[model samples]
Target: MKEIVQINLDNEMDLILAHKRCMKIAEMCGMASSLQTRFATAVSEVARCAIAKGKDSLLVLNINIIKATQKEITAIITDNVDLKSCSPDAFIYASKISHHIEYQYSNNQSLTKISLPIPSPGLLSETKIKTLIDYFKFETPLSPYDEIRKKNIELIALSEKLAESENKYKQLANTIPILICVINERNNVLLVNESLENYLDKPLLSFDRKTLMNFIHTEDIDGILEGWNKAKQNRSNFLGETRIKKDSNYIWHLISIVPNKTEDGSFNSWLVYFVDINAQKMMVETLKDNTQLKLIQHELENANSKLRFKNKELEQFAYIASHDLQEPLRKIMIMLSRAGEHLSEDQKKKYYFDRITSAAGRLSNLITDVLNYSRIENKEQYFEKVDLNKIIIDVLGDLSLVIEEKHAVINVNPLPTVFGLDTQLRQLLYNLINNALKFNAKQPSVKVLHENVPKDEHLPIGAENYEVIAISDNGIGMDSKYSNRIFDMFQRLHERDQYGGNGIGLALCRRIIENHNGIINFTSKPDEGTTFWIYFPKNKLYTAKLSLKNQSSN
Candidate 1:
């Protein structure tokens, strides 16, 4: 016996989980949909009863060979509380639905096992069983709400497909050899094509929905009935695969139900098709076995990427809460405590109060910057052809006051128009130019230049050329070792009092450049001026637009 999934039945959600796993295992074992639902329903009933009457309830799904040509998918539900002292309703129900049921009472616990026979035991070969085990071990379970949503989405897609050729359904049903039938809202047979009558070996109008179920394999009856019930409730189309009996043998068919609606959009009847898909089903089985491991690897990669991104964001927030936000808060608290000692001295008391107000203002600014940094990922930003020269002019205008105070000399060369977010591009230039004015020993002289270079390792992958923009300033530069660390959130090389602004500016600058699918790097030395290089893929118009749209959707 090989274990597939184990669930602790504690609540209604856990029951749903157990049922879903049971259904999946049955499907993977090459059991038809009819059998899958029967097995799942039996497990769910047993689990529900255990949850209500037992303690420490657990449901374990596994597979075991019964004979030379037959195997069974077994669900073993055990509870620490003895079901012999409770109710036998679930066990009685399971015995009727499953191929076999076994119940044993030992000590204070009760164990119930439900087994559903698999006709194609070869599907559960040793290699396939190991694959199933590995797949389930790494699989993330979907919530009940997600499962419902997924079903609704599938139903909607099927409905759309049906609607595409709905006007010609009658003509096609009569002309083609495919088995087709029509049933009223009450599931009474209204019409049947000659193909359907010939296939069933019964005359038209002699069969209703109930009679149709008789021709379907017992394993499939519950599933088709459930699909019909759901379709009637939603007045939507339904599609499922099942095995239908022809004479004494059963063959796989794709069953589709297209609901007929009145002009007011109320459902009146259903047009159903029984498409023989046995050959396609066999092909799908072979393909699935070969591709299952690859699909699992792809899913695992996507999940890991998303998890890493979320973890990085969480680390940033944690760092701010633990370190950045603490300094100003601590200073405010200390100033308030010192203020009490100088109550008799008005000047000293006022001085302490002023310092407290300054600390509070700094704290508020830090919070705003942090929020803005976070919003870079969430803001609804659109990309267009952005003129770098215009961005520089706007940023310089915003810093005109600072430029005058520092007696700055600004030299700007003609820059190219690039595809990017306009507002973020403006912010990027503002931060870089503003930093040029702020971090200066004597006079501030800044130059903005642009160049075009052939593709190289420094450019984005698969790029034809690079559009490079350089912003150099005569300012107090830093050690080259701190270049990368400076781009981290709340990272600063200088003391708080030395720099007038928070350390989030460079981090935001880096994020903005990244959002544009570009790179920002710099060369610096202590006392010498720093030159920041911005590289954008020259032929990235289409790529950047598509990448930006994908990022926005995510």
Candidate 2:
């Protein structure tokens, strides 16, 4: 046997070169033209398969001489790739072209060999073989058939990839919340997701540009066109708010258009999405109406003005109350569902159950706070000479268990008596003391001090003197930036997980102080401590009358 040629099959060009060389070798062996074509076709197919599925492949051509009686031409394609994994179609095509085709595997290499036998008298002469060898020295022209086959394979692979991409696109568009539609450059709808069909109450197959335009509100057509034109000119996205007809009623919808362009920078299509914005639009309108109403009623009678303001405040409070309450209820439901799953595991069950219990306790506290806030003005008026010392003592007794657990110390500085509602004053002292104790990191020490401001000290009118009560505590204080915000309902400074409270303690105290015609203020530094000052006016006439009434009743 003699080696005719050896070529590395690394790419398409290498495969073509191998095929041409095989054909020329078969010709030089004096094989028939038909046999030459068959041998070359088989070599081309096998070489392509090896290059596509294998790594570092080589194509070898050899001459076989059997005892000077017979001569044969053979081509072998070998690579370090799995032969069983090669496409069956390539092997089938090669087998049809030549009966001497066979696959061999040895030394961890896959080899496909094809042989063409020459007749005894048809063996090539020495001169003709040398000429063929010289021809092989130059590059061979690519076979048209092989070129077509390569193109066909590429097209098949590309088609499969495109189909996969289309499937993923459909899945994403249908699963998302927004309505999606694809439109071609001719203004014709090409595809729409199920969301669009559901929104229109009709199948998308029956929709076109005209049909879609009919469903849009008449006033929005010009705006939509203007936005679309701008998007096209700038090659950017278009966004606008419009109304679309659904169930014979118009609803606000936000439309977003994303332009798709071809490689030549020409328009190809557009991707449009619709999002429902009726709730947001309605909220804006409601706020506008409320502002206008308030401005119109500002000059009304004092009684009516107060009533209107109170009504507005109640409305706002109701909105906030419902929203805040839902948070805890949602947590309770989620924890309960999780607890049901871990009922058999005692530790897991207890963990989730404790969370559910905490959420429920928070819900209860919020309801109680809201109830107390609402009843601040509804309580019967009962002003009397209330002793601050007695109120503080009662509050301390009520919180005795917490005080003991925290190892808290209480200091008093002769709090003066004042004319106010006894129950409100008791609640005010309780909240302030509880806040100081709850936020403390170390053993809490609280001081209750008071001083009487003389007449020249500038107090509210109709007051002989003002009693300023200062309650200071060593606790985990907060930044001064949130000093005013601390009195807002549901405005918590720390995360609920760190400091567990409903954020209503200070608000409740503020309300209670306001009912007694007093003002409350606070000062604090982070991690240091805080002090709350309450100013209560002393009205001589009211105190004297209340004292006389108390004497008569006794």
Candidate 3:
């Protein structure tokens, strides 16, 4: 007698769940360790095939018993899954591969060889086998479809062709002296190519199908099981890294398992390959220990800032990197403006220049912004306590000339003091004000509002004090879609001439806020004014908030 069960789980996680459910049954059945392991491998192969084929489908499984002196379990699983155009025969042929097990007898005698055909994907071995053990009865063979044989030949031919193309693989394996062996789902060694002897360093019998798993490194056992389980249920190949214990140490190897199935969809065996990557592993360790080399890339921002220090020396450097990018930009603006000037009384070039100049100017600005953004932290800068209101007032006063020229309406409120570099804060306020006024074609209205929400602020609570500095504006609002990237350097939502400034302003603001051990984020909407909220935390080592602003304001 045997038990039969079937399940159809769609999600990858669901497949994992089903596999676990099956393993639990095997444990409950109190089956022999070897047989329990075999059951697990059987369930895994079928489950893998189910997920890999697509469209969350169900697997139908039939379980039966073969009885002589002892009872042996047999199962046949099938799926009604409609798959994409592929050779059904190929999948079936891959599954038909049988596994050989040399069983251990309790008496002081010899072992017996047993050939067990593994179950197909989906049905959990624990469920069916335990059910079979619970109600034992004799039954005829639950034979597989005979017609699948015709397709198996075709599948074998195709698989051989696939493997044959790797004609150089064996030669390379031999030259490298790498150990490569293929094992069945039960971890029974089906075949070990000539190149594999080097790693095993043992006789062929020691690494045969019966004892194949013993050679696997203890730490890698779980990983191998995981990958195999995934492949069994989902119908996929497993490739991963593991270690093989040798002389009390581990030798790392990259192991791969590919499933070959028969035409009737019986998993035949696994094709595994291994490669020794000791040199690469050593290189990784060397880099991990090199502190200076590790920090160099992160410090590139500092180097770039020094490169952009308004020096005549770097003008040529930037010229080389950007490569005369500004020239074409200037020429386009000139040509467009000139063409507009030369047009007849009826025609206007300002309209055309708006689009062309905007495009060229935006491109030029993007290049400049990228270079400048990369250079901000390269140069040394000091930090101090800064009064937010003063920075706003200073920027407002600086732009007073432009404000009056454009008849812009300005609204301001008192702001709190923060610990940060003055120049950055001033720059932050300037960009906010600039972006606000620049994007507006009508009214030219701008309002700067401040709020203090220190403790209520969403900041990493690692310091004594936390301050939230919100810089909200009332102007032609930006789209909320760009709210996330509004702080990204070179990311502009409008034309350059339409809003004349490098887009690095917000990005710089973010860097400054982060340097102060603070957070910076935004909330905005299309046609609704945007608000950039910056957080500042008071800590001894991280004091980026206000000194520069205080000194300048004082």
Q: Pick the candidate with the highest TM-score.
A: 2
Which is the better candidate, 1 or 3, if ranked by lDDT? 1
In model 2, the worst 10-residue window by lDDT is 542-551
Of candidates 3 and 1, the better by TM-score: 1
- Over 4 Å off in model 3, which ranges? 1-320, 327-358, 378-381, 384-390, 405-408, 413-420, 440-451, 454-464, 476-482, 490-504, 525-528, 543-554
Question: What tens digits encode model 3's per-residue C-alpha lDDT throughout 124-158?
Answer: 35565556444323322211222222222333343
lDDT of 2 by residue, 298-390 (tens): 433443654556455544563455444555455544545543552344533322345545655776677677766665662325777899989
- Clashes in model 1: which pairs? 34-219, 34-220, 35-219
Lowest-scoring 10 consecutive residues by lDDT in candidate 3?
139-148
List clash counts for every candidate, in order. Answer: 3, 0, 49
Writing each residue's lDDT as its tens digit, candidate 1 over 177-251 gives: 467888887777888887777787556552345676668887788888889888888877899998978888888
TM-score of 1: 0.38
Candidate 2's TM-score reads 0.39
Off by over 4 Å in 2: 1-351, 378-381, 452-464, 540-554
Cα RMSD for predicted model 1: 25.3
Ranking by lDDT: 1, 2, 3
